[model samples]
Target: MKQFWDFGMEQAKSCIFPVVIFLSLAITKVIHLSLIARYDLILIICLVTQVLMVVTKRETWDEVKVICVFHLIGLALELYKTHMGSWAYPEEAWTKISGVPLYSGFMYASVASYMCQAWRRFDITLGNWPSTWVVCALSAGIYFNFYTDHFIYDFRWVLKVATLIIFHRTVVYFTVNDRTYKMPVALSFVLIGFFIWVAENIATFFSAWQYPNQEQGWHLVGIGKMSSWLLLVIVSFMIVATLKHVKGKMKQAPKLKTEKTSF
Candidate 1:
């Protein structure tokens, strides 16, 4: 019981960015802003929130860089997906490009931020991690399928199966307080994806954006979307893992130099 409580507390701490964003969404929905557009206001809030996190030592610069990369990746997908009519930002804003608001990318960034925070707070490490090339190949396929599927065949299910096979042996080890816990990496992806899907429903409920069906009225987002989020969460995880791996290698470089000099 105590371990569960500690785990929940750590998870809540890791969710700071996402909670701020959701609150901004809900608050902006009901308030009237004369000078700034609602979308632009949200963008400002996100930027400020990120800066504050860095200033307060809640996030490292490297983590911020990773989050930025995810932001761009997500924004590009938004541009294409919106053009394809998958979903849309119906509100008018100066910060919008080709109908998608810039703030939308931060929604994706928030996911990366949560992963980074949780990793640090939980002292996370991976076991039986796959080789770099294999991980990159799978990540690339998953991302490209998000685009290519709209034009050609939807290879998501194929990619999903591939994910399970590739990561079947990988385990995530994380510490909660003094105790440590482990879970299958694939299962972690599904759990994070499920939560993101729930967050998506809340975002749409607050009129953050609208789908075709929601244009008439708001309703629960379909369960099928969880599959998409699961794949996306995998991609996000692989990217963070790669960056962390690179950083770990870089940190060992000076140690290797010192060892050689001592010999």
Candidate 2:
């Protein structure tokens, strides 16, 4: 019971920033800020929060860089998706560019932020990670599918199969209050994806963005989006793993399993 409690608390601590940001965005819609639009306010809050994380050492500089990568990657997708009519921001703001508020990218960055913070806070490690090239290629393929699927045959299922093959043996390890815990890496992605889907519903409810069908009124985002989020989680995880998980000559070791972080 104590272990479960501690684990839950640790999860909550790791989730603080994302949860707070989402709820604050939802709540901010109710408050009228005279000079600034709600979307602009969100952007300001996100930037300040990111700076504060580094200022207080809640996140390291490397982690911040990883988060920035997520931001840019996400913004690129947002630009394309918005152009393709995937979804849209209904409100007007000075930060809007091609119908996407700059702050929207932070939603993706928040996931990386959570992952990095959770990794350090929980002394997380990985085992049986697939080859760097294979994982990187899979990440790239998944990302490409997000755009190319609209124009040609969707290869998401094929990519999903490839991911399963590569990650079949991968496991994530972490410590919670001195007792070690482990989970299949794929399962973690699915769990996180589901929660992100839930958050998406909430974001839409608060008018963060709307789909074609949602223009009339808010409705649940299709269940299919969870699959997309799962793939995205993999991409985000791989990028951060490249920075934090890969280190030194451990790459040369055969069957690299245990992490070197002296946990």
Candidate 3:
């Protein structure tokens, strides 16, 4: 019971960024602001929340870099996806480009923020990690498929199979408190994806954005979206993993140089 309580607490702590985003969504939905658009207001709130996190020492500058990279990646995807009519942001806002609000990218950044925080708070490490080349190729493929699928064949299933094969042996080790726990990397992806899917429903409920079918009335997002989220979570994980790996190597370089000089 104690361990479960501690684990829940840590998970909540890791979710602070996402919680702030969601709260902004809900609050802006209820409050009417004529001078400032809701979408722009949400963007401001997200920016302020990020700055506060950094100022409070909750997130490091290095992690902020990772989040910024995700913000760009997500914004690009949003531009393409909105152009393709995957979804629509109905509200007008100054921060919108091509009908997509800039705040939308922060939605993706929140995911990266959660992963970064969880990695630190839970003392996470990967076992039997794949080679860098394989991981990079897979991540690239997963990302491009989102765009290419609109024209060519959808290879999500194939990518899912590839992901399973590539990560079958990999395990994520995380500490809850004093005891360490382990889970399959693939399973973790699915779990995170599921929760994100739930968050999606909440976001849409507050009119964050709407699918074509959802423009009429609110309904549950399709279960199929969970698979999309699962693939996305994998991409997010790979980005975070790559950054951490690079930082680890950078730290080791100084030690190696000193050792070589001494020898």
Clashes of each: 0, 0, 0
My TM-score estimates for the predictions, one after another, are 0.94, 0.92, 0.94
- As for model 2, its CA RMSD to the true structure in angstroms is 3.9
- Model 2 scores a C-alpha lDDT of 0.84
Error of 2 at 219 (Å): 0.6
- Native-vs-model 3 lDDT? 0.91
The TM-score between candidate 1 and the true structure equals: 0.94
TM-score of model 3 (CA atoms): 0.94
- Candidate 1 per-residue lDDT over residues 1-263, each given as its tens digit: 88779889999999999999999999999997999999999999999999999999999999999999999999999999999999988888999999999999999999999999998888888878889999999999999999998779999999999988889988787766655566789889989999999999999999898989999899999999999999999999999999999888212111122222221
> Model 3, stretches more than 4 Å misplaced?
249-263
lDDT per residue as tens, model 3, 117-233: 998998778878889899999999999999999999999999999999999998777776556677789999999999999999999999999999998899999999999999999
lDDT of 1 at 228: 93
| lDDT against the true structure, each candidate | 0.90, 0.84, 0.91
**Model 2 C-alpha lDDT per residue in residues 44-151, reported as the tens digit of each score:** 989889888889988889888888999999999999999999998989899999999999999999999899888888777787887788878889999999999999
Q: Which residue window of length 10 is worst by lDDT in model 1? A: 250-259
